[model samples]
Structure formats: C-alpha cells, structure tokens
Target: MIFDFNKTTDISGWRVVDDGVMGGRSQGSFALNANGNGVFSGTVSLENNGGFSSVRYQTDQMALGSYSKFVLKLKGDGKSYQFRVRSSFRERFSYIGKFETTGKKQTIEIPFATMYPAFRGRTLDLDNYNGETLVEIAFLIGNKKAENFKLEIVSIAVE
Candidate 1:
C-alpha cells in the first residue's frame, strides 16, 4: 500500500497548494473528515489568473518497479481532477493523468505507463512515467474556470 486514510492516519505531510503562488486567488484545504477520510476541497478562482487548487504529499523515495498501476478509492463531486506524481521532488515537472469523478464512490486506476510528463499545464516532450521510483504524489483540480470542488479519498495504493 502506498497510502491509506483511516481514523488514525496521520496526514501531516499533506499540503494544499493553490494558484496563489502565481498571483492567483484560489483557496484549498486538506483534512480528515468525521468519517476519517481525507478530504480535499477548495474553490478555484479565476481572479488574478488563478484557476487551480491542489493537495500534495511528499515522501521518501519508493521503489515501485513492480507496480504497473495505482488505484484510488475516492468520491468526487462529478468533476475532473489530475493525479500526479514525481520520481524526484527536485524535478520541475510531474507525470499526470486526468480522471473524471461520477459523484459517487469509485475506484480509479491509473496506469503508470500512461502518465505523461507535464509542467504548468503543458505537456512536455519527455517520455511517460518510468514506474521505477516515486517521491511525490498529488491531486489537482483546474478546469480553467471558477468553481468549487471536493474529493474524499479513502486510500491510494499500487498494484
């Protein structure tokens, strides 16, 4: 298991990053709900060119060469989101895959081989995820408009 959220899970490593870093007015928050699931919720404001909100977790490098995909157990507000990863935290770009939630519980599986390299919403010419090692993981919502989003995540695992 890569990460799981339960009644006792410690989520201190998780952080919310909005468009404020680039002069945007987005606001996001991450926390465990009463049911013990990790909740990522926020408003994506287009004010000041801001239109994205994300939550990220950085961890020790994990060798995952044997894992071909990641499975996310989550519930969303019928919106779209990006699941992202970085082999190394120092890298400026992340390998990302987009998924749409159905406003109900769902298991989203993202193949490591299909995550393309991207930076600031632009796809890079580099190859896709190598599935060798990972140091960071994130979820981002940025549909290019102002809206509110909420995602309840039960767990994240690779298989």
Candidate 2:
C-alpha cells in the first residue's frame, strides 16, 4: 500500500496520542502546524522522572494473517526512537522495537516477527503479525532527560 499525505483517505485510519495518563496532566504537549507538513510538533519531555513520551497513529481495523512488514517514511531529531505496535488480544503490547533516525527522510521497514519486543510495555512471544489486529503505532523517547524530538510521517504501508 502507498500512503500519500495529501490524500485524506490515507490519513483517515490514523489517530494522535500524546503524554500523560487519561484525564491528567498528561504529556506536556500540543499540536503544531496543523495546515503545514508538520502536524505533530512538541517537545518530548522526559520530566517527572519520565522515560517515554510519544504519538501514536492507528488504523480503524486490520487485516490479520496477511501482511508481512510495515514501511514508512520518517524524519526525526538527532536521537534514537522506538517503534511500538500492539497485539489485538492484549491490553499492553506483544511487540516493541527501537530504531534510530537519520534526521532526514528515510524508509524504515520492520518485519512483524523481529520487531515484537521491548524494554518496556507488556510482553508476548508472537511469531507473526500476519493477521493480528493493528492496534497502535508509537514513537517513544527512552528513559532519560528531555529529548526535543520531531517526527514527520510522510507515508506508511503494509505488505
């Protein structure tokens, strides 16, 4: 699948998620440049002894037992970031992964099997995401000081 930013249908399946818990101080955040190319702009403050802060975009539904990999075009600050996905059957997530940014537009491809584990979040030994319900896509800042980060997702596809 090819995702075009100018196409509304391509972005309809996505949602935004940010800091803080439900109904709380939450993450120190805001939306930036709604009409511009940069829709998500905010500082990922790892404050209050915070380790991870992120934004997630998800599809309304998923075609399980089908796709093999997830691909996207992304640009980030001069730091590393984690890409997280959830299992359809669990509250936490079955898989989690880390990837570094080039500070430029680059294609990041993740195979379902190898990208399903992390240092945080729930754990599950899932072999394939072939038909697993696509839950969420998260960009996380690891446990550390405030990391001023930016991510512009130009496109996303499954195959």
Candidate 3:
C-alpha cells in the first residue's frame, strides 16, 4: 500500500521534533508543497545539549503481516537520514534504518530485517525488527554536527 502525497491536501499528521525537547536549540518544520509533496526542512544544532532534529508522522497501526520492505520516494541534499519505525506507542526504542541521498530524486528501499533497535543513539542488544505492525515513522538527521537540511518526500509504501 502506498501513501501518496499527491492525494493529500495537507501534511496535517506530520510534526517537527527538534532537540529542544531535551533542552537543545535545533529547529525544524514540516509542510506540504504546492505539488502535494511533503517537505521536511530544518537546522541541526549541537547547542544546549542538542544533537539531532527530526519529523515524525503518526499513523494508524500498519499491519505489515507479510511485507518485508518499505519503499520511499524522495529527494534529499546529499546527506544521510535515519528512518525509524515504532511498533508500539510506549516503546522507548525504535527500529532504525539508515539511508543516504545523492542530491537527486530517487526511490529508497529499506528492508525490515536490516533495521536495528536504538534509543538516544545507543544501539540495543535486541534483535532486528520483525514486527507485524507499525505505529509511527520518522525521518531524522543527526550526524553529530550542525547543518541545514531539506528533504522532499513524494510517497511512502510497503511491498
């Protein structure tokens, strides 16, 4: 199933999550472009205990019973971003999948079996994601440095 941006009127379900939550000074925002794609842009700062910036989309439980991969169509600024999946709302850690962009539009395929569990940048000893449902998804840019970032997302799907 595909969540096509062109069919949505606004990015109402998306929200920014800067480091300020932990007393950091980073800033970020999410909005829908005129073409219906979602744009996640922000500045990452290492000030005041901050080291990361992200945006998350809360979705209904996604039953990926037999799906093993997630496909993302997007454009980025030649940087790396972490794709996170949460299987439960109260889970402290998320399954993370990392991908790098080439400064051009492309499709990125992330396999569930390759995702690792992590919390606050620390890798957990738990096994890779083999969950049947996903409650949330996020895109984070936290390269341990300060920088500006912009990512345009066309669609997200599972197959």
Clashes per prediction? Answer: 0, 9, 0
Q: Using TM-score as the measure, name the better of candidate 2 and candidate 3.
A: 3
TM-scores, in order shown?
A: 0.98, 0.71, 0.95
User: lDDT of all predictions, in order shown?
Assistant: 0.96, 0.58, 0.89
lDDT of 2: 0.58
By descending lDDT, how would the candidates be arranged?
1, 3, 2
Positional deviation of residue 79's Cα in model 1 after best superposition, in angstroms: 0.2
Give the per-residue lDDT digits (tens) of candidate 3, residues 57-128: 888887898899999999999999999999888887999999999999999999999999999999999989
Leading candidate by TM-score: 1
Show pairs that collide, candidate 3: none
Q: Which ten residues in a row have the lowest lDDT in candidate 2?
A: 23-32
TM-score of 2: 0.71
lDDT of 1 by residue, 1-159 (tens): 888999899999999999999999999999999989999998999999899999999999999998999999999999999999999878989999899999999999999999999999899999999899999999999999899999999999999
